[model samples]
Target: MNSPDVSALEITSSQACRVALRGPELIIEAANKAFVRSAGRDGFLGLPGWEAFPELRGQGYLELLDQVYRTKKPFVGLKMPILFQPSKGAPMEEHVTDFIYRPIEDGSGHVTGVFIESYDRTEWARA
Candidate 1:
């Protein structure tokens, strides 16, 4: 039997709602199509995570990211509730998702960024 191709795995992973944030400020470095759709907009690249999703502030999400980055440990949130603002001046919408915050480390073992992945579970959670 043959092992799976790493590039193929990357492609599959990119299909999910994923985003990569860099530095302690958590600047949005990269985001996938599913992430854009889930965010309900684009142009997130280059913005701080808090700026991209202001509603997330004071919600414990940012703190969680900070914790993961600081400790270089991953956090798994199952069926977590998140409030998102689809657009400017829009009301916040509640969403439930399963999310993971994985710390990205450099060659020297210094945490430099975070890899975020989430799966929406709104309908299932509501049902």
Candidate 2:
């Protein structure tokens, strides 16, 4: 599926939004560096399916995506809990500082992909 180029986005999206684009099948089309770091994935580009994000699975993220795609509307989520896999032990959960899911629009005004924004809620890595 054809999607917008990452380079087409403004510099603000790169710095502030932690934006990324997913294709028709939710394949990661492109991701800014912030997104890579936040997800703790090094090579995030080209990953397929929404399932690629373990924290997002069955956690209302998919449902949110579906709602955005169907309505072609932008959504913002604040202080939501984002479950993360810990390095030393079992999975850990933290409140997401903030996030946004915006539907990408095609020339025909149809939803083609989505733009993501995420913020890590941990403080100073004290854990």
Which one wins on TM-score? 1
Model 1 scores a TM of 0.87
The global C-alpha lDDT for each of the candidates, from Candidate 1 onward, is 0.82, 0.64
lDDT, candidate 1, equals 0.82
Q: How badly does each model clash, as a count of residue pairs? A: 0, 0
Q: Give the Å error, residue 1, model 1.
A: 27
lDDT of 1 by residue, 42-69 (tens): 8878999999888998999999999999
Clashing pairs in 2: none
Tell me the tens digit of each residue's lDDT in model 2 across 1-127.
Answer: 3335345465235554355555566667776666655555555467763656665677787778778777777889877776765332446666455778888877676787787767765563335
